[model samples]
Target: MVKMGVEEGEVMQHSMLTKSIERAQRKVEENNFGIRKRLLEYDDVMNSQRTVIYSKRKNALFGERLDVDLNNMIFDVAEEIVAEAKEQGNFEDFQIEVIRIFAITPEITAEEFAQGKIEGLTDRLFEQAINAYHHKIDAIGALTVPVLNNVYAERGQIVENVVIPFTDGIRGIQVSANLKKAIETNGKEVFKSFEKGIVLALIDEAWKEHLREMDDLKQSVQNAVYEQKDPIIIYKMEAFNLFKSMLAAMNKDVVSFIFKGEIPGQETTSLQARQVNQAPVKTIETKAELVSPTGVSEEDVNDGPKEPVRNENTVGRNDECPCGSGKKYKN
Candidate 1:
């Protein structure tokens, strides 16, 4: 029984020692993991710092060169501005516009340029950009003018439009205005001409009708003056004035219608309408005075005479001059 007890106690002590060894080994493993993690972290920081230093150095060295390259490509400036990004390694912004400026400087650099898969046009455009900076603009612009009026006209005339451009301080200023843009008379020009014709005809017709109406009125006044041959010459002068105005209004297109206002030795029938329409004129008229008038009856006629008036002044011309005065020149 004592020997058995001794073996059991020894087993317990051995087991405790094994557990302590395992715990120490676990602590060592945890410390190793921490050291490895810190080393990896340090390596990551060094790599990041190396990348930043390299980028900043690259930009500082080629920074001005990149700008020069862009200026040579775009012909925009002698000392152009080139952009740089902090995150994307080196020469990224410089490379962007460089592909447009010159052929890939593959021979100049030990490494192949990145843009090997872009289109051919992109390369050509970039090359042209660089080439443009090398030379002056000598390109001649082109224009086309369509022939108007059957490509030619025997006697037709044409006018042209002009363009003016301002070139105070620009690198290139082109006066690009059509000298004489050809517009066919069969086109909108013809339509505009036709429109003007229609408007003129309308004006002419309006004035024509108006004048003819006025002419008719003047002729009537002239006839009235002729019938009043026994009246004062002032009325005939008025009739002449009306007739003159009739001719003026009738021929306004050919004449200016400027009134000299001088009736002259021979009177004019111009003032008849104005004067006739203005005042009143009186004449001796009775039923007996117009009954036998058949030579020409201007006014409406009556067929029969009603009667005549008898007066005590029915004396001879030598007797008081038939004016009812008791005196005569020979009495």
Candidate 2:
């Protein structure tokens, strides 16, 4: 049921086709076939990457081994941070990024990591991140139910006052205080739901960003041909690097937002589509006439025996003037 674009229902007809007609229609123009072959070549490259992302999304949606997935996300974040720090030859900026986003202070420093020969750097970072998370959970204890219920109650009251129209067929429901109290009483399950939401939201945001960058690269990579470079080769290399960066970003964003008690919103990563509609067109009319060397009018020439050649015979300076009103040819 997936379609490239919406189609009018009137045009969506399925007709019975005979075997003979089907075979005859298979004879495509060579040029068109070649064009499609080239198109698929580029599409194959993107398809492979798209498959991996979609698989990940399916897993998240189906709640498959979610706890293990969360653990992997944490490790991924740790590894990415360590890798970046290693590349930059310093951890000051790394620490700053982590602190600013996740609100966690790592006791380990870049200088210290260098001193330790970079051993167990990832483990140390993960431990610090986990500790920060656990501390937040402990702080929310006992008062978690009461706090969540109060927030949900306020939201329910607002929903009762505001009239929201139904979309398609279904209308969104506001979180009621009773539902919130039930969730709070359910204990760890409620928080697990929150964590899952955060992770999926971050993954979606990061993937969208990666797709946007890839699209931009696809559009502009042709400029490489001016330098006698292969655009496909350049695209593949850049895409690989971009995918790696996307994974790292997803890992970092998920963990950071979860620890910060926030969900990544559309405002964080949404991109506006640029429209290039055709400009308005205007048409103008003008009249043109040809004057013959014999001083013949355009209408007279058209009405003559045949079309007159404008420059067939030249008027020499010593010849009589072709125009009857002229005094001399050179005058």
TM-score of each predicted structure versus truth? 0.16, 0.55
Residue 204 in model 2: lDDT: 82
- Every candidate's lDDT: 0.34, 0.60
Q: Pick by TM-score: which candidate is best?
A: 2
* Residue-by-residue lDDT tens digits, candidate 2, 1-331: 3374645663443455465556666665666797788668678878998897777676667767776776788877777767777778776877886686568888886567776544388788778877777776555333344434443454534221111111111211111122333334543433455555556666787888888898898888889999999888888898889988787777766666566663123311211111111232221111112445677767775784875678778888977899986667998
For the record, the alpha-carbon RMSD of candidate 2 to the native fold, in angstroms, is 24.2
Residues forming the 10-long window of minimal summed lDDT in candidate 1: 254-263
Per-model root-mean-square deviation over C-alphas? 49.3, 24.2
**What is the Cα-based TM-score of model 1?**
0.16
State how far residue 307 of model 2 sits from its true place (Å): 82
Backbone-clash count (model 1) = 13
